[model samples]
Target: MKDISRNDLLTKIQEVEFACLDLNLYLDTHPKDQKALMDFNMLAEEACRLRKIYEMKYGPLTNFGFSLAKYPFNWINDPWPWEYQ
Candidate 1:
């Protein structure tokens, strides 16, 4: 995949996460939904992979993520999710 901007990648991760949560909610009410369950698992995996990529390239997406900062406190230098344009 071509390199995407940090904001775009973040948006993609957020979208996938949302989809996973929504599918999970649907599965809760319809426990026999095989298609929904498959979709949920796929989205969940995608969200996790994207989150790892984002965190590695940038900084921690959450408080408990891995930090690969090469300089002094890059975590503080990076913008909050909402602060992105």
Candidate 2:
């Protein structure tokens, strides 16, 4: 797959996360729904993969954990998520 821009990747992650949450809520009342369960699992995996890619390319999404930065801790150099373009 072509490398997606940071913004696009973030958007993709957000969309997948939202889908996973919605499916989870549905499954809470209908636990036997195999189709919804499958979709939820797929979305959850996609969200995790997208997050790993984002962290590898940009930095950790958290403020102080699992972030590997350059010598000067350049994670601070990037715009905050709310300020993303």
Candidate 3:
């Protein structure tokens, strides 16, 4: 994929987050909805993959640092949510 603008990536991330949240809310009342559960899982996986890509190119937006392998020192470079464009 071409390098996405920070703002675009942030927007996409927010959209995915909202989708996940909405799905969770529905699942709370419809726990036995197998189709919904499968769809939610797929969305969750996509969101995770997008997040990892964004973090790798920019910096961490969550508590978990982008480069877990580089640990300790790398954590210091993690970006706060507000840092995103």
Find the number of clashing residue pairs for candidate 2: 0
Q: Each candidate's TM vs. the true structure?
A: 0.80, 0.79, 0.78
Give per-residue CA lDDT, model 3, range 1-85, as digits (tens).
4578877888888898899999999999999999999989999998998788877776666554343433444445635556644
lDDT of 2 by residue, 1-85 (tens): 3479989988888888899889999999999999999889988988888888887777777666565556667667658655788
Against the correct fold, how does model 2 do in TM-score?
A: 0.79
Best by TM-score: 1
Model 1, residue 79: distance off in Å is 1.3
| Model 3 stretches astray by more than 4 angstroms | 64-79
Alpha carbon deviation, residue 75, candidate 1 (Å): 3.1
| Segments in model 2 whose C-alpha atoms lie over 4 Å from true places | 64-75
Worst 10 residues of 3 by lDDT: 64-73
lDDT of 1 by residue, 1-85 (tens): 3389988998898899889889889999999999999889888888888987887787777654444455565667647756777
Score candidate 3 by lDDT: 0.77
